[model samples]
Target: MSKLIFVNLPVADLPRSIAFYEGVGATKNPQFSDDTAACMVVSETIHVMLLTHAKYRQFTAKAIADARTTSEVLICVSEDSRESVDARVSAAVSAGGTADPTPTQDFGFMYGRSYEDPDGHIWEVMWMDMAAANEAMACEGAGQAA
Candidate 1:
């Protein structure tokens, strides 16, 4: 069987977080959702559990760091193209996220941008052309150019 991943994150408001995720094109999995948490389906094998701060604390003894002041984690997702990256970042902004001031660009090999959600969680959207990367690596191997 294929492995599945569940990314659990703390949210100040469950309903607001659900709305924000919905605005950015994620669907809720009712079968795994309840009053304290909502399950957002990112893909067939990936699920994001948006848990209330109070409930989330029960899972860990360490104090929860305020995401606004300190980053707890950075969730990165890959897209098909740079345009798709920009579109997703734009969608995030429209859904109450703030884009990072600078975006990372590595000359056709890879590109990425970051956004801060209302609760201050950081998310990075990126695109990498493996074909281009392989070709560049081949050139490097021959000691010619990128």
Candidate 2:
């Protein structure tokens, strides 16, 4: 069986978080959700477990760092093309998430942008052209790529 990945994030409002996730294309999985927690399916293999601040306290004794005030994690997802990357970021912004201030990356073979959810968790959407990357590698000298 294929392995599944679950990213757990602490959210101030569970329902709001679920709505934000849904806006960005994730479907809520009621099977693994409850009043204090939500299971958001990002893809077939990726799921996000959104836990309320109080619910999160059960998993750790350390203080939860506010994602808005402090960097905790940058969750990245791959898209099929550059347009797809931009679309996701746009959807996120329209759903009340803030776009990352950093400029969008535009390498010849790769493109990426990021957005922060209402709870301040960053989500990066990236797309890589493998064929272009392979071609670039073929044309480049060893030192340049390194």
Candidate 3:
């Protein structure tokens, strides 16, 4: 069986976060959602668990870092095309997210953009040409292990 990843995030408002996630193209799985937590399905293999701050404390004693002040991590997802990458970030902004401090990248073969969710969690949307990337890497000796 393939391994699945469940990203657990602390949310200040469950319903608001749910709405934001849905706006950004995630599906809410009601079977795994409740008053204190929401299961946002990104893909078959990727699920994001949004837990209320109080409920999050049940899983960990450490205080949750204010993501706006301190970044714990950046969540990146890939899309089918460069246009899709921009569309996702644009949707995020319309859904109450802010653009990342970093600017969008356009390397011809790969394009990426980032946004910070309402809670200040970072998310990057990217698109890459795998075949072109592999060829470039080979030409640059990037894939060779000496």
Candidate 4:
């Protein structure tokens, strides 16, 4: 069976967080959702659990790091193309997120941009050219490229 991933994040407000994620094209999984938490389906295998701070603490003994004050994690998603990355970031900005000033582009191999949500959660939108990466790997294997 394929492995499943559930990323649980603490949110100050569950409803607001759900609305923000919905704006970014994510659908809520009502089957696993409730007043304390909402399951956001990012993809078939990826699910984000936006749990209220009070409820989220019940799952872990460690204190929840305030995302607004510290960098606890950076969520990154791969896009099909660079334009898609840009579009996603733009949508994020329009939905009350802040886009990073500069985007990282490493030739034709990889490109990425970042946005921070209202609560300071970072989301990176990236595009990776697997064909270019494979070609570069081949050249490096031949001892000609870095």
**Top-scoring candidate (lDDT):** 2
Q: Per-residue CA lDDT of candidate 1, range 6-109, in tens?
A: 99999998998998888777899999999999999987888889999888989998887899988688889888889988888898889888887346655778
- Who is ahead in lDDT, 2 or 3? 2
Residue range 16-103, candidate 3, lDDT tens digits:
9999999899999999999999999999999999999999999999989898899889889999998898788888889998975568
What are the RMSDs of all candidates, in order? Answer: 2.2, 1.8, 2.2, 2.2
| lDDT, candidates in the order shown | 0.86, 0.92, 0.90, 0.85
Q: Candidate 3's error at 144, in angstroms?
A: 10
| Model 3 TM-score on a 0 to 1 scale | 0.93
TM-score per candidate, chains pooled:
0.90, 0.93, 0.93, 0.89
Score residue 50 of candidate 2 by CA lDDT: 98
Worst 10 residues of 4 by lDDT: 99-108
Relative to the true structure, candidate 2 reaches a TM of 0.93
Ranking of predictions according to lDDT:
2, 3, 1, 4
> Candidates sorted by TM-score, descending order?
2, 3, 1, 4
On a 0 to 1 TM-score scale, where does candidate 4 land against the true structure? 0.89
lDDT of 2: 0.92
Tell me which residue pairs clash in candidate 1: none
> Which 10 residues in a row give candidate 1 its minimum summed lDDT?
99-108
